[model samples]
Target: MQAVAIMKQARISPQKARLVADQVRDLPVGRALEILRFSNKKAAQLIKNVLESAIANAEHNEGADIDE
Candidate 1:
């Protein structure tokens, strides 16, 4: 799964973005969602959106379903 964090009209440094993105990389769907949900960082929301998209893609393309 891929998690993308986008900064728009914000003064976030690229290094910080990369660091946050790295934290979410290769994490399982559930844990990643939890991290994004409770995180106070703005980047976390962007990452969460990307992660949700990835999860949806996995469900549609890979036939992997996340247990709700």
Candidate 2:
């Protein structure tokens, strides 16, 4: 099962966030988080937060044992 998270009315511009997203695209959650954690961009933090929420939702709603 797949999980999703949405952040409405975020302060950052979509164009800026998309730049961060493009870099993290197709990466494993662990790897993505690593990149996000060390990234100096504000959008990286925003995307990281949403990704964490999605992972939590998958565990709670779908009972998927996402190990970390």
Candidate 3:
């Protein structure tokens, strides 16, 4: 699930939030995090957190390591 933190940080309208979330959704964790990291938007930090969570979930639940 996308984190609510994205909304809080970006101060973005609901439509924009949905668009941003949709853009990143289903993206590989590392690539998603990189996209967020270089972003100028405030929502980037929140997006990074969500991506990190997704990465952690994938690592623990699926025995996949994003570092590799």
- Give me the candidate number with maximum lDDT: 2
**Residue 44 lDDT in candidate 1:** 80
Tell me how many residue pairs clash in candidate 3. Answer: 0
Models ranked on TM-score: 2, 1, 3
Off by over 4 Å in 3: 1-13
Write down the lDDT that model 3 would get.
0.63
Higher-ranked by lDDT: 2 or 3: 2
Clash tally, candidates in order: 0, 0, 0
Spell out the clash pairs found in candidate 1.
none
Evaluated against the true structure, the overall lDDT of model 1 is 0.71
lDDT of 1 by residue, 1-68 (tens): 34233336645677766777788777777887888799888778777776787667767777765674
- Runs in model 1 lying further than 4 Å from the true structure: 1-13
Model 2 sits at a Cα RMSD from the real structure of: 1.2
Clashing pairs in 2: none
Best by TM-score: 2
